[model samples]
Target: MPQSHPRPYGTLAVVGAAALGVVLAACSGGGPAPKASDLSSADRAKVSTGGTLRWALDAEPTTLNTFQADATPDTALLAEAVLPTLFTLDQHADATPDPDYLTGVEQTSQQPQTIVYHLNPKAVWSDGKPLSAADFAAQWQALNGRSSAYWTARTDGYDSISSVSQGAGPHDVKVVFAKPYAAWKGLFTPLYPAAATGTADAFNDGSRTRLAADSGPFTLSGLKDLKALDGAAVTAVRNPHWWGAPAKLDAIAFTPAAPDTRLAALRAGKLDVADLSRAVEDGTPVAQAASVPGTVLHRASAPAFLQLTLNGGSGPLADPDLRRAVAQAVDRTAIAEAVLKPLGLPVLPLGNHLVMADQHGYEDDSSALAPGADNATRHLDAAGWHLAAAPAGDAAHRAPAAAPVRTKDGRPLGLTLLIRTGSAEDVQVAKLLTDQLGRIGVPLRTVTVAGDSFFADHVAAGSFDLALFSWPAAAFPVADELPLYAKPAVQPDGSLNNGQNLSATGTDEVDQLLAKAAAALDPSEAARLTTEADTRIWQEAPSLPLFQRPQLVAVRTGVANAGAFGFTAPHFQDLGFTGH
Candidate 1:
């Protein structure tokens, strides 16, 4: 999912951070490299019970439904606590059946690509209804993109399902795909109850504010059930009917606040955990938080990476040659250094758009589009964009003021870049990009929009020539990322459905390769097909990868099984306080 920040897909709350000084010291050869995940791993026996965890949220979720178009990362954060998923990702990014929700899962037939999910007999919703196949069937019908009534965010794997039915028992769900779908495990995550998805009206609006039922370790805590806190937005209490390991914390309270204000709350002991990812903009809070008693910092490469999205739907970028020129004009290495250096993380520019550098199947397919002003100028010149007349001077002694400007057919080569209003990361990237593009004789101006409306109103709406944002990396890359690069299709009603491809760029070849990759059962075959598609994406210049953003989190020392979870989904039941 494309978001303003690089939050991991399907991840719960970020745990905490290691001391800023420690991370700097490590980077400066005072210690070893950072680990994949820095959460204080501990066995269940070591975790103490009976404490409320005060978690900070970037924003209050506009909708509780993760499948809705308006749903943000905050919505997914809340859903992880109260909803059930068929599978969860481990530290290695491998999908494992969540035993609490699924007893077992087996492929029944390869002909129609049938799969049978054995649900946990003890699993039941908060309304005392047993978890059954009906929920899966209803959810599939709502999100398979077969009807116009339901508005789903993405229908990658679900759209491949031909039918979802009950097996021999009520707790068994049998899913039959019309085509072979390799990323079957990604479907029905955070499954909704049948009651919510039974109708188009309820599926769209019922979970917008509150959930009708839940089947996870925590249940949505009602306002009347507990006293209100000063700034908390929502709260979740331990589910009494949870059949698996009970929740370690008595309750989890979500308090919404800006990134810069969270550290102050943490210092005042109001917030138990706070994300410090924004420390790249200002290292002051990170250094200052290290002195706070019982505070620790942890950092890791976030699953998501920042990228420069070029809108190819219209404007000067509608020409593929100009898009390539824009891509070559970007100095990815310099941009990564500007953002990651302050956070004490290695500055390595990402090469592939489909997969992160740390993820499996990652390969540098970015060799074709090298970043340099010379390359940009060459491409622009080849596209018939010539330099405008400058003040005559000795070629060797020309002043910076006499730098060449690109023009074609009496029009100057200029573009508008859209970014979030208060995002320091976006502003910093924009500043560096402005300088980079200017050197190539192109004028790039930035338009700042409200953070809340950045994606819905601008990026997704194709209202800008360029946009800077991050996409949350999914465990199932081939299936999850297909929409981000797939070509926009004109509907029968003459409307364009771009899905999640904010760049408005794609090729039929790329789409065919992605489709083959999605259906490739062999891991090697899938990897090869995905790499081929990524290479085409680079040539098309839809987006240029910058680098993997670091997930920096600060927390009290006693917090365990939390913080900087790189790719693993946090186990809420395993999260608790340990007496220090």
Candidate 2:
């Protein structure tokens, strides 16, 4: 996968709307998302050294370890500056070996699918320990999924590795896969130090708040009081021992700032770079922020998207027909226009769940579930549900104030939709969905919950019939997203192992195609399989993709090599400010 952020299970995003609220006008004259990265580009020589880059973070990270379940995008940003990445994904989502960590990487064998990695001889840990095969083996052991002792967030490529050992020289590491494992380049990214993954206790909890060691261009310097939102929550200083190009900035301070506060922070010169991806809320003037003097507003097609997850573990959604009905009733294009158009982004509804719009092998799978109130009603009626107290075809059903309710076997066809409390975007989207579902005689209720405990206490716990959240995309979609849609299996102890598929519903055919996609060596074939799997997911109605969220950042005009990166990974060593 790309050096993308670690997958935070159901991260909520705050999107701002027009001052008059969501204008339900026809979407027109829109184009596909941009394929190129939008980071302000400049040569290394032009960038001056010895200045602090105060970057804004969305929130304080729950843990420093990227492998932990609670880790967020903040954790990934910290890892990118302070940890070594063997391969970095380009703007086209192609993986290329990073010379700072690996001189070369090649597949040496075909029978058992073996790969050899040539580690940079000068790359060493903060304590002077050389990076070796020991680090690779330790990470593999912890994330391979064979042992229950290690609590790993994801095990995509690692689970396929049969063994990791030393190869031709002391700096060469060999990895043998039990399967084809076409996404091998994604493994061991931001490779953890052996000391952090040497044992179960160390791997699970040791790095919750701190890093065991760092081996990159920068090192963790200090973590200010997290409760003090105005202070630097996390800081990284240039590493003098770095053997590659030295980091140009003297230090990077990650300060916690909400979407509404970033504009003021940037104008006051307190922040050098502010990520405005979540700066979407009601009555917020996002477009006018572009005129801020000495700053540039950059836009890039983000690898993340906002979506609605339909819980299939229990309740009315457990019935596939009802789930399909709910899916059909949603006007995705209208929702996209309401939330994204105000921010000056493309207003196209996302089609495929796995492949992003700007990526290769993308196919609109929305045709599987046709969107219309009449179509939704037909599905519900066929599933033995009928509107009670009023005629099924009455005109009053279309009214939002007194909509008719459906009932089957004395049970009302009512569902609860969960949204984070402070997210105006979530509230706006939910209200639209509530009106749409109500027209089909399905009563929908919106419930507000605390943002911090939203995912852990509700979404992950299967506590809602419908939930709204975002999923960050990666270069290797099949490897990264398989767990999200795979079927829950029964373990030997009669327990359920759902992996990360919170839907609680899946099919055998979907699983087979996803498995084939993971082991496919040819890129075209892998993409084809992934597209097919997405079609099935749409048919199953586990989740509905709304729109691709664009990454918008406000940065000082002189800042170089950093901003909205899109599909490309940020080159920390090349990021700095030019003293214009």
Candidate 3:
């Protein structure tokens, strides 16, 4: 996954446009979401640590390895509890070096963009081994993309590094970059111990060989199964080898619950917290969780977003105007409100490509749709599309389901839309979109792709006329934009590269500009170049973000430091329950 925020469901994003007014405060619907501080806080007066807090994951992870493309959000969250990454993002979107691991991190030289990392001498792996320079060197080689033995989904930041050398101390590491990369912090995230990623066989088999606590607040506890659990629930207790402030909770368990059953589990007090996203189910979980007494839904702005990717191949959507009209015809407001409002999430769409709504250097760029069905009709008419007159007849052709679909050159506008199964929200959104487009004379036929192989098979093969999914984010936004929109490239496995899988759409201009954005030394310059590239993306209308998808969570009233976390990973060491 290489830090990709994988979700079982989809989300929406907001963007700003001049004519349509693309500001965050105005365009994003719904009330303001909760602050990270709010959920992470306990009644300092009533706070007492040391109790088991049961949490719910959207799905069980296949492997404990978070670097694999097959890894899910559950695994990523679990990794945060065990892995000791060198850095973590603060609410301000600034990368802060974790004093628990690295005492210092800075770029010492600009000629080659040399960055130095100073590890704390007191910090030791759970196995009691010193966190040394060898660990850093091995991780760099395994992930540098130069080795074919390791199966890594992404190699953005690592690809820019020219060399890694030992620093003044045994615990110090100096890295030299081939080019200046502003998002350098992303390289060490979800970092694995050197013992795990040292060699080809070790990188593949070593990661899974051990799972007990090695260097985090909570260790495997050997209390039960750790990384070994998949179908069964995962459990972890306070690490006996911990050398820092002790973890608030004695043990934590990530119990798996189907989206439909999560609300019941929360109501039953079977779980203290659960990730109940609208993209997972319709709106029942939100309303149900709300009705439950002692439960509060916490939402924060997330980088993930729900979007409609129009096929650029031989389809009616190949026409940019048609794509723009589709954007207009499908009501974003209706979609967001219907699906997110009940969950108490913002309906505002994130319009920018380089950053999330709450993140710094982010602004709305999505308002270009011209804002309604009237504009949609205008665009369609311009593209030689004619709407069939209202069907006037008996029940066979009535107001419901029966309508005069669109026709162009005497051919009816008919298309098949692929929606992944298992997401109640996806099905609902698909139905709503079908109805909305139907009113506009666009006849949509919906189909369900197997959830397991949806992206690997259907999307990569371009076996779709229309598709809906979430565009997840990593610690760095620009790192993902290139693959998402760059020209399509096939991998050695014969599978479509995930980034180019969206209708196999790409352009040399987009690729070059994205590369420029990645290498830009000036922060303002990087933002400027990426924004310029976004303008072209808007014009092409390849895929437009609907809203800034809500990162929603329902937790027990007294629990603290556990809720809907955005760009930053959850700090399990600080989580606790406030009670006697």
Candidate 4:
């Protein structure tokens, strides 16, 4: 669990207003213009000499493959070096499908459901093999047939895709759907080679380590065990045969740093870039680090969501009022102010929509559920729980009903909250939440488990009452929320069912709206249906959204022109050394 950090609103507002004013003034011809050749010889010298950029990551890559499972930030960082998508998400957060490898399909009157793509003429794999439409066809088939669990969200709109075929010409691919899909453009991500689709098992056997073969700017020279060198780090060198503008850095080493050690390494000048986790940002470290000259701190609005998920089985949480009470009890502002602001980050208001504002289909119209001490008490009261003031000598406490939901029956409402004890931040968050819930008279107990065991068995097995977890933003759309909440979708196998429906919420209206939204070709109709679905989810309160965690990138002051791509932090290609 990442620690919560609140951004200083007053300071941020002043700075942001000043920056906006400068931009507005510039547009109105207020600032002086600069001439060309502003670059100094010393600066040019630094840019010409490529060197290894050391970046400290928070975690290790679980799997090298991105398509097989939801890739973590660490996994994504490594994958970007080896695998290049058909189109990149731009700085403005729009998916600009690469014209070289992907082209828009024109819908003729006769072929209303057809999409055609054109591969770049120069595009070739790291192995010098030509990438063709057949590779994409094979990848699509593999995703729909073999890795349905992982591909369901990406291919939700494409369920109507009848067939994928290669065009008559080289590097051309055509896909024909049973019906029109408004989000048809989302299918243009990186595809696997045709060779891997011989069998489902063969494709997912984890033997595709060298699938690192792509047209990306960099390729895996070798998977050097960074853990062996210094626990959980991997060094990726630039690919000589890359098709795009070659990466400026010769090699980028990704080192896994714990929350406490990340800033220390940054201050010591050993690390060129560091991801400021929530724990460090809320602490005194961010202020200390930002005070240093030549160091710049950049924060991006992430689409990620951290939520408190309830188990929907015939448990104590099976009650809707109790869930609502818990949702109201959570102090999102406190979490943001105490956790986020100190780190120089902004807190996102709580709302029904799980998708971040930057992502498509996000509806900002939904109001966040407010938090209050009285509101918590009222919700608990409505749920048939009463808070009894503590007797003389003890800490103020809520009296436990002889029976859980005492108003309904005499039973203990005690429930276990399964949390991962892997990181220090996780433990801290769980403690904070436990204390808060305790004040509201919720008899919640903390059960800390190892990471692998928790996800592998407990979460999948549906053995816990409440779980605190986070979901990373995918390039897919709102329709992805369906499988997460749909009841029949949860499989007996240990794979994730639906992300948004983590609590196994069973709502027919939500399901109908989501299904309609998926099939509708009109953006307006789809947005309406999705918004309706979000409304129902919020009302039901299966999962209580915590806050949108901020992603921090700390770079040396000498790194020039470093920029972030989409919501994901800055890429290695955007970074360059500017010091002589």
Candidate 5:
């Protein structure tokens, strides 16, 4: 599974930051080196080692616990450095065994969907517990969502497991699935040493400030409790017990800077890596960094897409025809062009709801069934939402001025568009939508909230007619995508099972195809079924996917082996300093 699920933190949030004054590559004193991307093998051989990397977390990672939804995007950085996963996706987005933790994985049974995992004999936790089947069993039980006391954020793969038991040896774990799962390779990933997950309290809140155990290439190096001062930050140093290729970097400092201040911090030598994905615009500090002494920029396709999930369960969007009309009236190309095209990226609207445009098994559902603005007006008129002369207002309010913002039956066609504030891209996109939808007699009022809280405040609650946000693609797309497009189910916490199922419009046919694709062992059948899933989702027009969100970063030249990871964990062991 080549899924990269970025949480509310634009995929990887900044956990914390204390601005320390420093310069760029010129200040760090590194000689000429490779490009900004991950180094080639030949190039890697010539690289130097042993230095610290200050990575900017886009937002403070709310929870270090990978089991919870609040974990920040950069949690992966800490997770990969500490906990070990059984398997990791490769550059090709295919599952590859992580030699440090897993020796082998085999499908043991077909009918009951049994799978066997062989743990590395030498793998041991920082607590001295041998990597055994017990850790897997504990993870399966705690994350299956069977216990009301367990506060797991995602139970996608775990929910399908029927049992997890030890085999001939304690290190051998056998998993029996009640239902077949396609991305089974992603299970028990970022395995917290059993010491951390043995109890519900520990599983939920135990790792709040610091991890209980470590087995990966790096261990906690400094203070866990972050303070206002630079010296008190939590840092990671090479783990002594790590059995794999020894980690090259001496240490990695987890720091945070306010999103707006990251580029400035990077320029002044306070930060080593700033996720300058959005900071590349003309006037931003990142844009000016090109002229600076030492700066390296890396760009790659993010495993995510931007979407407008329409809410059809209540309010003005409840009407199917109105929803369809809104879908048609939205100019997705303009949205992409305004933001992505300037960066030499694609402006094509992503038609597939599950896989990205660049991934396999994607189908162009938008151009096939989605209608245009003229057809949108026709459909609305046919549905009795007749356009009338505009209300008196200035050119700024010309949309409402040009047409009546309601149905003929006094059903007022006004709708609300909720978006995260501080995102220049989203604001520009929302404005484009407001202007475009308003032109078609559908008046949209835009509401902005903080980025970190946007999902909880509006998306999870299904509180708005329309919303704009991006979905960070999971590492296992088929196994993890169901919760996103499935029929809406409200949980005990009032949060939704599928927050993006805002319209509550997923069909039984779509669900069936999703399951079929998940279980289809045959590669061809899985692809076909996934394509069918895309087509079925296209028919409903519940959400409009705009484009693949791009991943871009500005890194310090002193660092090597730093760039976007497509569908796998970053191999921190290989990242080191080439500094003076």
Candidate 6:
């Protein structure tokens, strides 16, 4: 991606609004009135008195602290209720900045480097104190100070910022950065309150049970009694003093429903909206309910990609030929058609690039590893291994070595493939690959690891030969991919670099490309550079691209304007109850 150019936020906003308008128009026949099924008929008959809207969420908040939680999506969703971002992503993943929440941005002589944003004139915390820039500074400092691995990664965007200053007014704040950053506007999520500073350690710690205060559209009203609700649920009432658009529903009650229970609830007219995972959508109940006249099922491509990460550093995967052979051994087309297409459209191929087609950095030029037994044979043959057609047939064998039979470093090639235990699909894929490799005269072993240890301890430590994993792509830009593939660096405290780069493969070229693209202000130029970098990365094949998962949301027919934000986010704000 091109790194350096300047563009105004106004142009971006207009483009975003246009894109969203087009999507909304396509989804609805021109903003029809909300349906009765969207809200309870009893509630619809009542006056437009705002009140709580009970909601069911699958997971609980992992942490009350925003900066401390990065891996889990539940944390971000909860924080959205408490803290507001300067800009919100529309249904098309376009930036919709809230100027009312921000007074002005002060630019230093260094163009895009040091920007000091003034908060809204009347902005105040839930505790009735003015919110200032110092709060942001303190929060960032506290998060960085604690040395939590997840928080450190989340705050990586602010690593360039040198300092933050608070002026006389609580809303007056200044931010100084070490270098010019083009995406500075993207960093303005809500900050912590001043009271959090006193319990800084406790606030920054992910172990905290209750959050201190909120500054967004809703405050933590109360935790629901699971016994009464029959599931994990929470209620968030609207903040009366909210500076932005007031929430239509007075309160949002979240109820957790299992994958199976969701469809039944929707069929029984129990829920206004429900999230549909692939496992749920493929079942007969959901399929029948989706086709029903009174219900509207909208599906979109999610901004996430399932990937197969190759162990590139050492062990059996050190040889590029072996990796290529393994890549060719699997039938991705069949996987897509059998595993994913039933859920939604099989829109694009899983190319070498890790990003989905909608992402800014996506490059479609690359080709996918061809499927079938013949192609697999060719790859195995090229890697100096012969394929045996049957079990007892000594029909295939390896040729004599030039010197001695050796691996990448004149050693034997042997390794175990690791995958998460609970995922049946992943286990099936791993076993299939293992069988294919066995035919090519390569010994392979499969092992299942616990989910927590698999991602945290094993992958980071480079303990496995190959693994199946998924990576999320942000809607803003492709510049955010730095932490995943960048080379690990030693910390000041002599700790190992354990950001997100599980493979531990660091390329100077990739780093330079990403840095330049991020620094570029122009979207087109940045996109171009990002595409080039993506091409390079894909060709290298550190991670093999899998299918893109589709976003499936089932809403009552009466629900109006419910859709996804491009492939980026689920736009809950666009949802409203339609009267019958």
Identify the leading candidate in terms of TM-score. 3
> What is the TM-score of candidate 2?
0.86
Candidate with better lDDT, 2 vs 4: 2
Better candidate number, 4 or 5, judged by lDDT: 5
**Tens-digit lDDT string for candidate 2 (1-580):** 1111223423531110000100111212245654346888999999999888888987777777777766677778788889988877666566678898998988898779899999999999987999999999999999898998898765667778899999989999999999888778778877889998989988877776666788889887344333333344588899988999899998888887877788888888888888776765433567766767789988767877888999987888988999999999999989988987777777788888876676656678788777778898898899999988853444565743456789999987899998877777888899899988888888888999887667778877778999987777656567667767889889999976666787888999999998888787766677667778888899999999898776778888889988888767788888999875
In model 3, the runs with Cα more than 4 Å from the true position are 1-40, 43-46, 221-230, 278-280, 283-285, 368-372, 388-391, 395-402, 489-499
Candidate with more favorable, higher TM-score: 1 or 6: 1
lDDT of 2: 0.78
In Å, residue 188's CA in model 6 sits off its true spot by 3.3
Which pairs of residues have clashing backbones in candidate 1? Answer: 15-563, 16-553, 16-563, 17-297, 17-298, 17-553, 17-554, 18-297, 18-298, 19-297
lDDT of 3 by residue, 1-580 (tens): 1123223333211110001001112122244432322255654445577888898866666556666555566766777788786777765355678888888987899888898999888877777888877777887888779988887655657777898888988888899999877677766766677877888776665565355335788876463433456556677788877777778888998788876788778888899988776524654655555666788877776656677778875577767778778877877768877876765565655566555666555655565446578888888888989987765667665645368777889888887888877767778889888998887788899989876667657665567778887767544556545666777667898754545437556667877887787777666677777677776676666776766666767888889877877667777778888764
User: Mind giving the per-residue lDDT tens digits that candidate 4 earns over 1-580?
Assistant: 1101111111110000000000000111122211101111123335644887787766665445444443345655666566646655543234556654555444442245676777776777776877776776666666554454332213434355677887767777778877655456555354555664435654565323444355566666566332344364677788788766667778877877765676778777878776554544335455665554556666655445566778775477777777767767766556645655665555554454434455544554333344565786787787777654433433355554332222345554567888766545456667777777766667678898876566556766667888876654434445445566675355678543544345766677877876776666555666667667777777666776666555555667676545223343344454567654
Better of 3 and 5 by TM-score: 3
Once fitted onto the true fold, the runs of candidate 5 whose alpha carbons sit more than 4 angstroms away are 1-42, 59-62, 221-231, 278-286, 289-292, 390-406, 410-412, 451-453, 489-500
Q: Residue by residue across 1-580, what tens digits does model 5's lDDT show?
A: 0112224436443211110001101111122211112322214554566777888765555567766756666676678777887766554355668888888888888788888988899999877778887788888888888997887766757888999899778778899989777667777877876667778888877766667777888887343543223433457888888888888878888776655676678778877766666565313533464444466666555666788889877777777777888888888777877876665454566666766554444456675446688988888889898876566767675643456575667656788888876677777888899999888878888998875567655666668889888777655556566655787666999964554455666678888888888777666677777767877776677888887776666677767777655444577788766644
The TM-score values for the models, in the order shown, are 0.86, 0.86, 0.87, 0.76, 0.85, 0.75
Sorted on lDDT, best first, the list reads 2, 1, 3, 5, 4, 6
Cα lDDT of all candidates, in order? 0.76, 0.78, 0.69, 0.56, 0.68, 0.55
Instruction: State model 4's lDDT.
Output: 0.56
Least lDDT summed over 10 consecutive residues: which range in candidate 5? 18-27
